[model samples]
Target: MASRLKKKCCTLYEAALEVVTSRYSFYKHDLEMLPDSVLFDVIYEVYEKGGIQPLREAFSRVDIVARLLKITDKRFCLIRSFQGALTSMFWEEVPRGTEEAVLQSQFLVEFGGGVPNSLAKGYENLCADLEDTQVQVDRLVETGLRLGGFLSDAGWFAESERILLACQEIFKWARKEGRIWLQILECCQKLLHVQSSYCHFEEADVTYNASVTTVVGLQGDFVTANLAVLYKEFSALHFNRSEYSLAHYWAVESLRAITTELPPCVIIEVFRQASKACVVKREFKRAALLAREVLCLANEVFDVNDPRYADALMDYGFFLINHDRVRQSVSIYELALDIRLAMFGPMNLHVAIAHEDLAYALYVYEYSSGRFIRAREHADKALFIMEKLLPRNHLLLASVRRVKALILEEIALDNMVHDAGTHILLQNAEELHKSALDLALRTFGERNVQTAKHFGNLGRLYQSMSRFQEAEAMHLKAIAIKENLLGSTDYEVGLSIGHLASLYNYHMKKYRKAEELYHRSLDISLKLFGESYSGLEYDYRGLIHVYHKLGDIEKVAQYTYVLNNWKIQRQLSLIQEDDPLDSVGSPLPIADVAALFFEDDLD
Candidate 1:
């Protein structure tokens, strides 16, 4: 009955709503003074909420009384109104009054069946639909490009594509709407997913495959933006794939083509996405440079005081620390931290993150530069900020504790350098290593990659103090974990192997093992970067050193000869090399000829 396209019941319901609205409140229970329309409207509101039985019975009785007396057409639903209301509730899954509810109803429909079909084949149809939609939308874009611009006023209104997407989404929502759904969904889906779907008059007849009538009514600023969005999604997902460089290039083009003026924050969002893609590839230098450029653009286009600019500055600081440029990164981070403090006060999560990050940076630089006292100060600040923001056993606070212990050990190593010949430093290093091991094991779990990092750092520290046996154990555990988590061919795994090989070559006098590890590390490093040439430089030097330790004069000479050839080849490569900082636009220097020491000395 609800699905029946009858106009009288809907009209009568609206009339009833009018009579009772001013005088009747749904919550009221004053039955004796209630108006006649109150009964009809009460049933109507109940029907809207899907409250079955009570409203249905009341309306059915009213219908019978009116029918027996032949009360007439205008108020006929007065008796069967409740039944009609119930029927209208979910008929054909037509959209509710708003978009959100429509999406919710889709979920409700899906929940009608329990369990997934439990096989890949069950999902094939769903995937195909999405792909089919993608194809049609692609065609829509080419048509729009050919036509040149939008066609009408409804098309011009803000978010016209949303209206179009709504048509498809609403239709796709049903198991029964089929053809009507396809036509409507395709119409909107084309505007967003395909550009060439918009018909062009000039291309009409034998001149074109489609006519101007194809556009329907696509015009105005909003329509232009809708079309531009299709182009943006296509470039982001297809042409660029993973390269941040290509993605940023297209984002700029598509953003400019849109007729509407996007907010500065939205523009900064594009920069954020591109920078993240760079970071995902571990291209820290490029990411930091892009983020810095974005920072300048954000502040210039928006406000110097914009929180987003400060946030961009903070992101650059993170990439710097990851790339080992902590010394130069400190000032930018401090600036961001100060800005967040001013904007959100001391306890904000943003301020806390900045404090923690700056502390981590200061810790790395302090120990490297022999300033443990200043490093400890920053560590304390980090601890305070983290305590306010996280639980007691949070991994970050525990990590900071390990950093403090490392700082103390570094101070011990400095004092022992003049007096005890590294014996005291070695002892302090053991205790600090234990602290790192304990904290990392408890905070990140024993098998975590981060736990392995702490082990490796401790191993290197011990190797520095000439504690060969202990360093060997730590490095072995680190290698095993790293090899399992990151493939053996990864640069980090190679670097760890090289560190172990160096200890055996220089301090332990284990020449055979040193030669074996060096070969292993070299093979992996060469696999990853041999073609790039720069990567091969470090690994080749390691191999040369290994050959020297084994007293293989012929092998050493052979490796050395290859290294020289590589240097010459590097000079000739057509890569857009960031000319060395020392070069400063001058002709490249010849290292072999200009060297102060003889090549034989290196041998």
Candidate 2:
């Protein structure tokens, strides 16, 4: 009736409302005091006058009548009750005062049915001449679903849930009458999406169970495809709960049932979730392989220049870098940068991110072969973009500045001499490192991972300046923070430990301390990436030097044999690189090579 009143003219209802509000409060008891006959007379007069005005002075102050009617929601459902009043006043003279009772009856009928579907019940009663209720039912379901979606998007979850439940009830009614199977499934999907989004996990679990049951009961071609979609939602449900193993299991199950029926986006999401799960489980090789498949699927499904394809490429590139394929990642990062540049121009945050990633790749590549110029160029570009786009102390700005500083440090070390120009280069590098560290400290405080990273970068810079005591302090801080936050066995903690080891072995001549640190760092690295890690070479050399200084000839010879055997194994692994997606070979210099390359004897 509210919907109908919106479509039709409600001038008389407006006049009555004006008259009632001016005389009495909007309370139900106050509105009930006005006589039915007198109110009807006033409405009729207003209708006759073309909805001009309603004056309470036209009636006597003491006019009262039967109190059979009740008010709800602090106002009259004016048009609905007024319609009955008009019918009795005009045409039903014998039943002159019967309209008020009819109004009350209609209200009771609607109140019994429920809120969203109450009007639909009224429609059924009014359209009793139409025998088919199916058309009305279909319209109700369609309108309710659309409204539910709109309300959900607007963050009105309660209203959306009510409307969807009404739609579900309609479907249930239809099912009892032996109709509608797929429609029920579709409604369940929509309802469960909303339930999951709002973290109504218990309700979503029930909906999920009902959807699975519906799927089992369904008789269709490729029912398993629908089952796969359900499985995908289940995976997401568990993923949100931080149950990675269950999420991965369901994701794999969904992948197995993949067909042309499933959307391309769903397929990509399944692979992405599986890959993320593998990463959380520390199955890096498997994660990289799955990430490669996501890139392949995205390349085939999306346009080459699409942002989604670029995003997939970026993910694949990051995984490749993590799994020790930095050279390939450089090209991947280049492609992502090109796409973002074309899509959003050069000044976008995405473009800056791509530059930052490419810069990191080139920086890591320096230890393998050396690309200092290209790496510095990308790092500077990233810094320039970030400085323009971000606030002065933004975390991203701090990160790009750190990368540029590291690049400068590398270049300065490469041009080592007792010359004025080299001193200026070192000075610039130190300033950038200090600025990055200050920004990190201000933005994330002292205990954050980013702050720890900045601390480690300063340690490397100070060590280059031959400030061994300062470098030791900085490395110790980084190690303490990383060990507290990321655990002692984290890859980052190992890097910090190794940096301190390098500082002791190469600069301070603290052979015993250097030996202990190198061994501890090696133990951490072996636990993280195992025996074939290429970065272990740096630790081996440090141990060899330490043992030589300590006059332990047996220990020195043992490390030499180990280092030589490691080099031969690395050579054989490079020869065995058969697949582009294979990330399980001898580990290359994993990220942050500066931590491992303090000495020129690394090669």
Candidate 3:
């Protein structure tokens, strides 16, 4: 290795010798022979003993070389210039890129492995001055953010936590050093994101409190805006934990923090989150209103063709469905589905989801219109895409299958004749409902709301099939699960109760039992959706039928009056001047009207 280095240095020396000799014709021989002179041997010995620095020092000994050669000072100066050039050539060839690589490697080691400590304390002990302290702080902040993000993306949460913790400490130092509040806020946001995402809720709470303190301490232009951001993120954290009440509280706080200067998209996002919390908390009216705001904002900010606008439209459609505006929601769902299909193409997941949304709205709308064809088509499309793309028991697939089953059941019910095609459709519907039930059991177990709904679906299907005993058992199971999971007065429990009452009144001739269940369901519906709720009609009719069975003409006439008033109010409520889909005073189809008059109730 020594000999090879020597040979390489000699080659470099000869190359410099050629350039120098060509540049200066005079003293060329003396300069060329200088390599074989005593000075050359002395310089080589210095290089061999102490390396490049010593070799460079030895090369700078121009006076000693001049004295030995007896050359003029002017010629010695020229010789010194050549010596410097040769030193630079060797210095340039030494590969200093390795040094930078080593520095980076060391920084990562300290970043990932170093103990969590105050950056101020570390800098005070190690840094020579404030300028160096500042430089260190800046480097740590910049690199920590970049590397921490990369580690997070790689799922190296532990290492990412270490780096982000170090960044937080540096941020603490920056705050004490009277750094800008915005900078500290930025660091706090990053730290909170890491903690909340990785289930570090305890640590995240501390960081959130600290961030709130920092924001409160500031008196700046973006104070409300920054608070809005913090509140929005904290709401999401609570949402991730399924703490809907707290999520709604923080979401409301975020909404309050919104300023006129805030971007439309940010406002829309906050409204969307708040609306989600509202939906989960069963605040349907508020959820629908906020969802409309999101849609309006998105429409204002984005092009109609934009996927974001489509997303907003889809969300609004969902809220509309929950708000009991199924007719309006059908149109909204159709628009969103068209946008998604046009932008994402047929096989895309968003397109499939859009189809599923439209399918759901259409399925519900078909109850009023008795139009199952379009609903079945959309349900089939969604089912086809989901079966091709998702796992067999995927949660989304289960939902789509449930919708398809309902659409098929509606079509089968429309066909009154017990022909081969009708029997086949009913069988297919039963299979789909069972398949959905199995998927729900596999994914969410028996106690879940989804599982309860599947039971209720089977109950309705059995009622349609004239399997009275099996229908009663399924309805009982559904009511029990829903009452246990969502409490007795929930909307879902009310629907199940209403269905069970229908089974009793229509098939079992248990008028007194049917009357009790119908009253209980009516109480729930009235409590949740008020007297104007269209669903109340089913329960009222069930009670009227029970009275008629008992030969109580007065009771039947009373309920008939109530049902007529309910229909009148519903028709009035359905009128909306701006929405053509509302179609004021439009009569429900014979199928739904028949349902109102002692038919099977599948609310």
Candidate 4:
């Protein structure tokens, strides 16, 4: 009986293969006509013994098998057919464009509901009788990771976390098997990456530390590269937490752990993180050097069109912006934007970030009609992308909205200069500022620094519109918030004071009140940055104007002398000709304000 059954199975398999190869057109319906037992045997044998071509041919007709599984109520057949499909697909190289479809199919088979009870039982039995547990574990890990990645990309943080945690467990089991430890470590790193991406920093830190400990415990010299990767992730975690010092330290450690055997991409990433940390710390020269190295290495090691090269360009642009090279920075940002647009198209988040950065730099470079239009265009693109990709109340979306509001305000101010339809621009600016303020209030609350900054911006906008009462109310609200959060002597408080002083000096013509506010602002500026700081020049000039207006000769002389001497000192210090920070008696402006939101150093 056994010999006869074997002969029958062989004959059925040969017939099925022949039909799959020769009658490809009707193979689907033909395969569906076969008995379930014979069909299952054929699929299993083809997946296991047949080479890549036959497996490909078999899977070409897998849809029919899938339909048969749905049509037939045979539980064993359903489970066996699914198992065979999974094996074939797992081993085959998924065609490039069909990744999403393949992943969807795998997800359905693994977790989609409506599996027959007997099929589930048969699957469990198959798992129990399988000799190679490692293969099963690997399949589970692969499926879970792919599903988790899909969820992560779709912004389903909670679902992705659940899948990633499952993958982590399977990886833990694989670790104990004494083989594939490096692959297991790689899996753990991927979990850490997903955790970090979703802002689950605490859990990410735990996973990172655990993975580091595991890699160290393995005591294999071959795993040093993995150790470097863990350190790089640790550095990124610290960077996200705003611990630039620790971030730089770990980044250096990662570079140190890497040898010639490791890929240069890892080294480039370390340098990128290290450069970002240096930028955050205001180590401009070192940051510039490291950024240049990153760009050079990326150009040498990666394709010129690769996103890594664009990332290096973006970082260099940011560094240039920090050093007050706005035009140079804008050009670099344009290059980065072009590369990203070419690589990922216009709607990508990276493209959005490049647009935001370039808009800010253009706005700061000059507030002409041309630059204002360009700035508004870029700001709108950034806002559009953020609206599509992020939740309504996300802090990142709020930040983009704030930048857009600033660009609109700049356009309104530019129109006010020429007296060319200022009302419409001002109204649009006002609306955007209010929307941004609302978002900031919702995301960061009223007492937050971001909320206070929005209030200050709106107050400035109102002052420009000659809405003095509303402007006073907004400015005072901003000052109250800043003082409450950062105390009276903070530089931010000084900014609010100077803005109010400007309102009184230029618009209200209240010289006495303006003089008082200017004095207060001068004191704060003096304390925060000594007399030599450029910000003090604004306070000094404001006080000079206020004292002159008030007909106070002695105070006027004192402030005039101070202003002149500060200018001479600035000359001696060799400050640039067109320093934006040297703007007289105004808030730091949107460019500096935007800097406050970029605390992460990287987009």
Candidate 5:
């Protein structure tokens, strides 16, 4: 009976191996269909074969391996087989048993089937048994790190944090060992990144402080590299809070800490953050220089079509657009669009963003029929993709809707000028603007800057339709919000003032009111952007026209002289480039002005 049983086991093992190693097209399905006893025999046979290449290939099919683990009665042997496959696949330099145990625990946690409780209990027992062994503790820490990273990337933030914190506790016992200490520091850094990303600022700060303390305690010349990482993380934290100056300072500190031996990606990130900070600070020349460096470094380290390269291109494009280099921005945006389209296909959210950005750049660059049509096409594509992928109240959806409304408003203006389809175009533009405003208010709240801009946009649309009372109300609401959020002296407040001033001067014939508002705008603009900003021209022209209408010849002459001097300064200072607005066009979108003065970096 014993001889018969041994022969039957051998026969079953051989049959299992034949099913796994056969080149039949449906082998995975067949493997899943095998009975538990035969599957157990296959697991033992595969392990005893001493070569795990076939098992590694099988494990790569995660679903098949998962089902096999689910059905197998010899759970420990099956898990060891899976781990051996992973070791062979990754060429991991660890003991087979320790690695197997770690892999099994992680698998159970991630897959969360009937085995999780058993796996949890087993891990607890193993930890208790190895409480005094430094080697086993170190292995456990590494396992936790890998598992934590996987969970973090999967967006299981709380789970990842729990695992990492548990690992930190285990690591405390082995902290005196340099290798273990470094691993612990890495776990802390990962936890901090996860916390910061989820807006758990208080927790992130605690992690940051703890990481700083750890780095300070470590005794090594190699600590500078670690310091660089800490500084970069702090920079990201400040950047998230819109503290651009602090972000830039920390980014610069990070750069200073980096030695030549550090990877180029680290230096690239520092430059990228610094460039974005400079853009927000309105330090255009410095921002452009840093952006160019980012492009160069990214090109050297990544393919031109790589997603990182595409992001750098988009950032540079936005910087150029902010500085009024619209034509240059169009080409850069096109390159980014091509890369994103190729990488993610046309319907992806990234592709939608690229399309929307390109559309906005083109719309700002020119408002001819051709440009408007093309811009509308891009905007429509973006709206379609966003509507498909995002919730109704997503801020990104509102942004795209605002872009579409701007395009329709411009088209309405065009039709009005030509006396063609005026009523329908105006009606469409008004409704779209209202829809965008409602969406913005819902997503960003009434006092939010974006919602304020939406009100200003609708104000401009109302003015175009000869609804002066509604326009005035909208403008006043926008101004109030701007003043409340940004204070009265901010450039954004200046923009609101200028918009209201234009309404008074052109539509309401309130010359004195227009003159007052224009002067206020001029004062704010000069204080915020200096005298040479191109936007100042709008205030100067408004003031001149208002004074002229009121027959205030003296003030008109004074403003004319100021305007002439400004024109001369502009001529001397302006770099020769394609001016998208050579002729007067419709009122600029509040979104465009907002982009210029308060651009937010999209990560």
Candidate 6:
């Protein structure tokens, strides 16, 4: 590497490509050589000479390119400069005779890796290479951002602010447009605030609304995926403002609308984000449909082993998980994991996350089947890698620990653990869960959807040990977190009532409390799904138990009337076990139980 840099041919501009390729694509960021000014010079010189397209073509390693551009602040600034430059230059007429036109079709594929200033690696060299300004301000701004790496960590407050403002100027230029430009400009302003992390979500709500109002043109039919993203952003703004009904309506509409005319890639991504929103709403059926569409499209466009294909496959797996298609979910996640490990390698973060998610799914299914060892193995692998990469107090690390603890819980329950493993598992599980809760409360605040999960997990742990008081306290905390985060009528707030009620009835012998929770949960089921839904059976069972405990024959008969009304729903089962409440899967693994629903078909 030293030998390559020492040779001074090709104006050192060529060296920038080498540096980028090595740093992001092939090697780590080398701190050993070059001052900040000197390093920035290389990146600037390269951008000036070759443009952004060429740098992108050089990026065969997708992860490296994305990491260099997205993960690090320095790279993000530089990438933004390139992006701004491209947006500015996109419509500019090339000098008539010097270069051939680069079509938009090639933009997404070969040169897609570049920032605004660049094109595909080799393509720019063929195009007119006319401009060599005395100073590239874009480069200078990028250099300042790179310098921030050293400065911000040291609290060089004034210098960092100045550097950021300089970058913002470039941002403003990039976002400028005539009609489309207005929303683009607004988006740039909001992005600036967000990148600074100075403004809160309240600011995001207001700005995002303004930005969305201007940006909903959805003009082009080509990049339908991009249009879907724009609408998703719009929906997100509504979501931020607590207009959830509007948010859901818009998000579903956006995905449904744009995907009708978009390219396959765009279609898949549209579905991915839409699936996330569906998951948030517990609209599992919609999410599953979108995920399947992604899979089908991926099969047409990408190889079975492609990363994007794996992504689609992974989502399909998770959709299966959420829909109570356990066997299918496990298969999909496994296949995706296999492809990712083959193409990207085992240590990749994407692959690691897949392992974690799949492990959880397996753990859930393990309740009713054999070979949960797959779940334990995958979770352990995820835990090991996260512990190596993340900070000691990172919430993600804590989540990984929680995953490990769950796996251990399964192991303890499955094996004949007389003493040592049981004590260790219980001790570690409690500590890790507490850490996870604390970290979530600190980072996301107490009302985050995540805090409810932490509380739910601890609550279940307590309930398992017959610690009803502790269990009730934890369950209430979970309920409180959700009720505060979402409104009383939101689907999320309804979930806590079931478990908290279960504790009230199951162990505390408090029939009234359990009855109340059952009624509330049933109300949500009736509202969201309708009274004829199969899920209402759980509510019925809970109430039956409550009435049995109370010796209330009249009320029990009244409940029976409702039960009889849904005999078709009861004779069959299709309850989904995916939880907004539990951080982990349920205590009762339902896969085998679910299998009964399809048993006749299979037979």
Scored by lDDT, model 2 comes in at 0.64
Task: Please give, for residues 412-441, the per-residue lDDT of candidate 2 as tens digits.
Answer: 778767567777887888888888789666
Residues 1-603 of candidate 1 have per-residue lDDT tens digits of: 766756455577567565554434453344335444554455445544555434433322312222222322213233233223222234445554655433433432343111111111222223244443544444332222211111111011112232333333433433433233234323542443222111111211211121122223343442443333433433343222223345455444544454425444444444454455445444444455446555655556544444556677776676655544556467768888786655444433345567666766676666546766766676556555555444455444555556655665677666665657456655665675566577567744656566776788788788777677988988888888877765676556777788788788778888788878878887875554354344456556777887887789999999899889878766655254332121122211223211311233422
Error of 1 at 243 (Å): 20
Candidate ranking under lDDT, highest first, comes to: 5, 3, 4, 2, 6, 1
lDDT score at residue 301, model 3, on the 0-100 scale = 72
Most TM-score-accurate candidate: 5
What are the per-residue Cα lDDT tens digits for candidate 4 across 180-208? Answer: 67656776766676676555666887888
lDDT per residue as tens, model 5, 1-603 = 888877655566567476674543345456667775665556556655654555654544423433454442344355445444433323364447665434433433333222222333333444456567767786676656765554453333555566566667775666476676677678877887667644456677788888888888888774666667778778777765445567778766765676667676666666676677667666665676567777777777767656667877887887877775677788889899997765544444667789999999889877534348878899988887666544565556667778887888888777566656776777777776777778666644687666788899889889988999999999999999878865787666788889999999999999899989998998877764576666788888898899889889998899899999998877665566543223213322323322433344522
In model 4, where do residues sit more than 4 Å from their true spots?
1-132, 139-166, 172-185, 191-224, 227-262, 368-370, 417-459, 462-543, 550-603
Specify the highest-lDDT model's number.
5
lDDT of 6 by residue, 511-532 (tens): 8878878888888867765655
| lDDT of model number 1 | 0.50
Q: Report clash pairs, candidate 5.
A: none
TM-score of each: 0.43, 0.54, 0.58, 0.59, 0.61, 0.58
| Residue 227, candidate 6: alpha-carbon lDDT | 47
| Separate clash counts for every candidate | 23, 0, 0, 0, 0, 13
Worst 10 residues of 6 by lDDT: 119-128
Q: lDDT for each of the candidates?
A: 0.50, 0.64, 0.66, 0.64, 0.67, 0.56
TM-score of 1: 0.43
Residue pairs clashing in model 3 are none
